[model samples]
Target: MDKIEEQLRLQVYLARCGVGSRRKCEEYISEGRVSVNGKSVLTPGTKVSDGDEVCYNGRPVHPEKEHVYIALHKPSGFICSNQDRDGRPLAIDLLSDATHRRLFNVGRLDYMTSGLLFFTNDGDFSKLMTHPSSHVEKEYVVTTKKEIPGELMEQFKKGISVQGEFFRLKNYTFKGTRTVHIVLEEGKNKELRKVFLSRNITLKSIHRIRVGNIKLTGLASGRFRKLTPREVEQLKNQALENKKNNRGKPKR
Candidate 1:
């Protein structure tokens, strides 16, 4: 066998190639689902280089030649997953033009939720935006079946506990009797729904509008556009500033 050059851990290589998260790639490796040069590898630590062919689930995985960053207005009923177990539509499937680029969503939006979503081939950028310490703000427009009580609004601002986990909104305002605009720094899974459920509030819909400084304005549902260079820089700056400001603080 030829000696591999520029060797990297198999999991790291998979992540850099936009296959999945490093930890997820580790799971794939441990399950004997990854191969290097035609041999299945069960060790996440196995090293491979540019010269070796890598495959996942019998399909080749290669690093993207150019990074792509896109903002998608995800429509409801599409899942934020690369592969859906139940055969539901995937969010990335909507990016028909970039299917071969190996792009992945940066953060997730539940199947029932809709709005601003980011897809990127840049793993480092994904890590920065999704990291808790970055404290990037995500804003949502929520519509409830009934008017939110004044006390519940106060609880939202002060923080509420649901299922033993505490969640706080950075800010919230009533757009109408049944609609509210809420901002959050922590992107916990189904956090908005969980919080509302805990308060006995029946949520009709939740639509995300913004992340950091990026807004969902002008984008139609199920459509996407490449992010401008300036937009990308602004997002990175926001993450860096948040990380600096929140240093030494506990991550929620």
Candidate 2:
């Protein structure tokens, strides 16, 4: 019997073509920007075979020959996106000399927040890292414009909700009068800034130092390096482990 040809979801195909992560490609499909064989593809789940012609924004695309995973020390003031309409710098630009593949940041970090960030051309890895069930730990060092407020730490430790967004700290340690190291697993958007702002505290800086088992120990600011094969495997194993541990539990 002849083996059946694998059929891939349209969005997954787009991601293999380096058209951003699978989630981002889904958005592209929803916006009517993707096409198959000259016809618009509005559904992300639409399946296509290897022989089908796929186009993105009228340009044909194919899967990348090799997958690249990069760890970037994104500096403050640079956006994570590939393009910025306001002329702001982009973090992906730092890797222009490193590799030619279209790499998307696995998860986002705000322009003002800098540190360990992952970029990859593989969509499955991106999905695994960003999926809610993974619950991968992210460590950050937050510095305040003034002495770190006592109430702020207490509220975070005890969990607080402002404007319907919940803020909680898995663990925290005071490194200095105005600095604290905090770890979070949920990693909501701009969570640290939101928590600080809720208590009328101004943040001087927010820097991420770790994601799962990957640590930003010697990597310099505004530089990037390819992830070791062992590191990549460890990340996958850790996320899978976390997903297994959190099975049937509600996201907090």
Candidate 3:
């Protein structure tokens, strides 16, 4: 007999096992990579409960005992990929002392940029923070090699298109002669770099400092810390609120 409380959708169960986000797990199901009770299952909402053997990618999977959310101060030159063909240093490697769970980066920081980044085994949390609909704000401290012209800065605020991709800052303010504090809602890949390149502005560096309500404070470079339960809930609530507020808005 399956207990009602213990039964969950197959995709959700795989996600809890640190396989990937629910949507990714659903893809695996559709590809016939998941099975239950010795039978291949290709349904998204198939019920899974205790006493039923589950396998993902031909390996048995069970929900992790505890879901972990960690904040890591990633340093420059570290790749976010768990495995890279180029043999670059990995940011997730810094958490070798943290835990043995299969943790994945919530969102990626590029190899050259560094600052507040998150790693977690919780697929739901990862999806919430990274989904475009959530509209979570990411703050960055951008330093240019030289002072940027007033006109160029204004153009960034007005938004510009480079290589057919739009780039714009939600808000930006001058921090100093060569530094600007920038906030982005989309955080598109290489967005800042590409825009700067388009205008011939040489960037000295870019460091992310915030994600939604979570700020990069007191965490040293190359260090990691566990997120408090309260912080996790607050972030989730913020994402939900952002999603609710942006409902029906056209995607960029």
Candidate 4:
């Protein structure tokens, strides 16, 4: 059999088909409403190759358009994802004034973790930003309950083994007595919280400041703006380079 040259995750392809957003696509899969080549897929990670038969609710699916990317200065209360069951505020609220294209946040920032959140309709771009291999740098400014010690700072920079998991901040520094800025290349759930807990430090708050080469930059919380052309280009180039680098490495 030939490879799926532009094959995407089945859930991702379902989302692209407008069955719903990506997250919802997973739920449909779990509910057994999605089928590839006539077989139901309950697993979320299955891949859907080009020309594959896809059906949802007994109907064929069509491809959705590439999305437009925007950076939102998400406020402390808004959820990072689309359509929360809790009915809490969502980042989409910030996009009311936006009329050009529908968008979705690339990655997530916890409702409590306010700051830069990327919104885009481009499924491929969103996929790139979230891929672990992208190695995209995400920077955050956080407040700690205890003062950061010098030794801990050095150790954080050097990396540590916690619960058999190796971790480190790509960069870390004390912003004040109980505050600091840290950068990481991965986005494990509750990762920052775990990083602090492992060091016996309590995380008071987390505010993301940057993603890839784009910074929040003067955008007030609860507000959003379309990405500039140059900013978009840089992100695409960065993702491309990361992909190329990964392709050259040996698989684990």
Candidate 5:
């Protein structure tokens, strides 16, 4: 049987209870607005287990379970974050007419790049996809400023190390003058751009085509859909398999 762990910091528990995110939860705790088992706790790192009593903002907290998973065809200029302080276009706004569930993106794609994005109330799933250890495959079609050299394409396939970030191009093929189909697993910020930039290629446009086994084929930009049950199951199984695969490997 697989061992399940429900361990997290106290502030994280509070944040999951809808009080706020971990950072915001710290503020509430420090201001004496949070309590556990009737007594206020100011520490953020206090370990919490399942069934622990927590109260925030004068209300008894309950674990949120009405999870929602949504896949959106993100358009350029839409930030992949829940809230942007700069008032820029955001992906969350794309789901404004959605069920009103407090959903967060499973992973992120930069504002300049557009394509498939996942959002969910399932924090576990979100963490799995967003976590570097998961190594879920993400595919993007990128346009470059100039023609890419055959040698650089070879380097892309062999993999390139950026600063300290190691990334391998799972698949790469020229689409046209300066466009290439690239598949990657590392979803770090602007990693794609940095990769091509290292090869002396300047990125002009980028659009994601898939995440893991889920694709944005029929889905048009700015549209959203609920992931089918099979897709969800496939993602979960893939995550578990990936976790098992990376048990003792060096951090990549």
Candidate 6:
């Protein structure tokens, strides 16, 4: 029996080669900035094989030398973006030596929030971890200005409607009158803030402590370490299981 040929869409191939995210690569394809086998390919769906030569903006795009998965203890002042127009510090800047490798944040942490932020060269892994349908849980320890009322706590546990949408905490524990440890599977932007705002609660601090099973333990703020193979596999499995469970559900 002959082995089947392996091929991937142009954009996906570019992402795998660390050129950019799949969406950015699609834009490059649409703009006629990508070429395969010396011919420009304007279609994002164009397929390419391992033997095909691929280039972007007249530069060769080689496959990533090795996939790097990193967990960073993001500080409060840095933005989780590839580039910042205002010259503010970016999360990627912390990985100085790996900048050339096209690492992307697995998800985002707001500039004011600090905690476990993941970086990876593998675009697929990033997508799996960040995609809404994946339903990966995020755990946070939040500090507020005042204690949460019993009524509001019950409302939070049940679910609350905000901006025509409903949001709920998967689980929460009150560490004290002003501190709460919360877990959320559907990580909408500023989700906790929205929940608190509805109840007239003032948020003082929000720090993510865990994603999936990975935790922000020994790593100091602004520091990072590569993830072990087992850790990476565990995350991938979680994403896969969540995706399977969420089949046919509307994606946010």
In terms of lDDT, which candidate is strongest? 2
Q: How do all the candidates rank in terms of lDDT, highest first?
A: 2, 3, 1, 6, 4, 5
Candidate achieving higher lDDT, 3 or 4 = 3
lDDT by residue for model 6 over 1-252, one digit each (tens)?
Answer: 112168788888887777667776798899999998899999889988767888889988866868989999999989988778999999889999755576878778998999999988787787788777888999999999988776776787798888877888888888998998999887878888888988789999999999999999999998999999999999999889989988998743
Could you tell me every candidate's TM-score relative to the true structure?
0.89, 0.94, 0.84, 0.79, 0.80, 0.83
| Stretches of candidate 1 exceeding 4 Å from the true structure | 1-7, 37-39, 43-52
Tens digit of per-residue lDDT, candidate 1, span 1-252: 233458889887887788776766898899988999999999889988768989999998777667889999999899998887899999899998855677788879999999999998787788898988888999999999988887887887897888788888999888999899999887789999998887788999999999988999999998999999999999999899989998988765
Tens-place lDDT per residue, model 5, 1-252, is: 111167778776765654444555677788888777788888778877766677776678766756677899999988976568999999889898887666667667888999999877665666677666777888899888899776776776786789988767777778887888888876667878888788778888899999999999999989999998889989989977998998899864
User: Across residues 176-248, which tens digit of lDDT does each residue of candidate 4 receive?
Assistant: 9888888988767767777779889988899999999998889887888889888888998998798788886
What is candidate 2's CA lDDT for residue 156? 87
lDDT score, candidate 3: 0.88
lDDT of all predictions, in order shown?
Answer: 0.87, 0.89, 0.88, 0.78, 0.78, 0.85
How many clashing pairs per prediction, in order? 0, 0, 0, 2, 0, 0
lDDT preference between candidates 1 and 5, better one: 1
Q: Give the per-residue lDDT digits (tens) of candidate 2, residues 1-252.
A: 112179989898888888988989999999999999899989889998867888888988888878899999999999989779999999999999988777899999999999999999998899899887898889999999888877778888888898998888889999999999999987888889888887788999999999999999999999889999999999999999999988988766
Q: Which stretches of candidate 5 lie over 4 Å from their true place?
A: 1-8, 11-44, 49-61, 250-252
Off by over 4 Å in 6: 1-7, 20-58, 98-100, 245-252
Best by TM-score: 2
Cα lDDT for residue 97, candidate 5: 89
Winner of 2 and 3 under TM-score: 2
In candidate 4, where is summed lDDT lowest over 10 consecutive residues?
15-24
